[model samples]
Target: MSTMIFSRTDETPGIHGHTRDCTGAKGSSTLAKLGKGDIVVVDAPDINRTLAQKLIDAHVGGVVNTGAFTTGNVPNFGPQMLLDADITLVENVDPELPGKVKNGKKGRLNDGKVYYGDRSIGQGEVLDEETARTRFLDAREALIDHMEALSGNTAEFVSTEAPLLIDGLGIPDLDVDMDDRKVLVVSPDPQLEEKLKSLRYFIREYDPVMIGVDQAVDELIGHGYRPAVIIGDPDLISSDNLRSGAAVILPADPDGHAAGLERIQDLGVGAMTFPAATGDATDLALLLAEYHGASMVVNLGPTLDLDRVFDTAAAPGTPSAMLSRLRVGNRLVDSTAVAELYRVSRSGGGWLWAILGILAAVVVIVLIAGLSGSDGFVDNLIDSWNNIALKFQDLFS
Candidate 1:
């Protein structure tokens, strides 16, 4: 898919930037380490929006991927995103090409030929936006085939994990009380930050058993609400927050290695391990809530997309994710619904109840602090609710 090259518009069609090894295989983990203007050398064929957004956020200058940009089997949405951001994208390079370019070394691109300090390291086809868009349209035709394969895999997973879903075989007990209560599970999704701004009021009202996966837990803690459980690695959260008495559950490796156990032990924090979960940790978090007898669960993350089964970085529609959703059924409430519920309650004639709820919450916080020696927890709850009240007063008055 050769197209016109305007990577650099000066005289020659080329770009010069520092080279960095960043395999798309490692997903966002590698992208998070990159700095602005560094050229990423990656190995992702079906790059999705999440990966591209990470590169955009890191302000990378270009991408050198060994895999063909689009093979018609899956969509390569990231290529267009990169090209739109004015980042040069060269693909189908030799498999060994990424290794020759050392990180922090100035690498130059001239008409799809990669050079490491004036020496040609490899040659590949560079893509323009028009060509990438054409390929992406063609790739959509193949998504049904991919969906069929994923459906087969989903059937297998349901057959394998049915016992856990039905009988609660591997679900663990937690210090947090969840039975008959609503559960709020937050994950690292694009909408998480903005959605939480309004949903914090829902938190104030429901006081759902809070579960946070990945660094999204920090968002909740920053809003003055500590998660009752943290379902990612201990290192994923701040050290101070990690010690704040949340039930920490790290996902074990598929081969039985306890992932993040050592880090939790090093931090001297109490933690447990969920069996290696399929897809994202957020899936397991939702399943955990469902099996723990949560009356309802509110999921704060990317809505599932079955077409993205191949995206390892939080593909919303992985087969395992499908299974988790099927297991949770209607109990898994979307954040949008939660938002609507909050709006309705705010508009209805219920100001007296809201005031009474806040007053009762304060009394409960004081009693819990006095009886349980959780002074810090009480203080945070008070501060968070007080902030909510001040905002409400400002908005109405």
Candidate 2:
């Protein structure tokens, strides 16, 4: 038996995605937190791939939620990760079931019902490993269907949003010289993060402009750099970073209601809003960079992957994104290919080479002087060389 705990869904007033409400206090601030051998009851309609994968990573005993635990509407790696981890997942449980599960109560899942303190809180369908795998395959099939539908309508959508490219003409008070500059747009993806870490050599060599999308600003901070520009919904960004002087870009709807407009304006920060052209904030960031004459855009963590399209917000935009990529072409590089293209030896140039060059010249001059036939020159050179060798020996010692 494992300890049981309850958490609100993303729809809950204050719960962020896959939040943990630790410290025993329940409010908008408390995220749901649990550990190994603990059963977590959540109110979300579906266990999203990210959360499901996280539970598996945390080694949780089991999960009880109101919805199924596939990739939701798109194809993603979450379901596959969960299946591989072999964590217990039960879904379609009643929302009120968590309440009936008293705190500190011991619970166990048998068949489809969760029993706590000899009482059955609710019943659900257990998602075995094979079922999870099947769901992932189905989600990927749906993504293919979505891409096909979008490919069918791409010419239409591109025609509609093509004029919107002019909308990226400018932000009210921000100025950036994007011509011929490499721009790195970061999104909050674990794989992207790891890829970025591995490409530090390339990053140092090029020093591309860093753009953070929403919560990815924090990820940028974690990597020892601050974003030059932060784009997307303002609510997802921390006030401290927003005030750190990065330009903000918002995605606007046709109705003129822009995501994060009020908050950004309330903070008195000027932001440029472009009519929503793509699905997720990262896509919007890439569009902004490309439209503004960026010479090159390197994306870390794009949702263009088949597994990535499973996110609800990303699924619809999958088609639009395809068109956007076609427009950007080789100018847009994902993190995966950065190493092969930009990675090079650090000794190519810079101060390190300058110092080595100076030392080499000094050694050459000394050798030339030593080769002189003059007895006095040879004597002085021998003494100086002996002194230098002694010094070198002392230094090494």
Error of 1 at 204 (Å): 1.8
Q: Which 10 successive residues of model 1 have the least lDDT summed?
A: 307-316
Each candidate's lDDT (Cα)? 0.78, 0.67
Candidate 2: tens digits of C-alpha lDDT, residues 99-128: 566544556665667764345668888778
C-alpha TM-score for every candidate: 0.53, 0.52
Residues 123-198, candidate 1: write the lDDT tens digits: 7898888888888887775566556666777777778667766776666688678898999999987777788877
Candidate 2's C-alpha runs over 4 A off are: 1-148, 152-156, 165-174, 306-314, 340-397
- The most accurate candidate by TM-score is 1
Among all candidates shown, the one with the greatest lDDT: 1
- Candidate 1, superposed: residue stretches over 4 Å from native: 1-137, 277-279, 306-317, 344-397
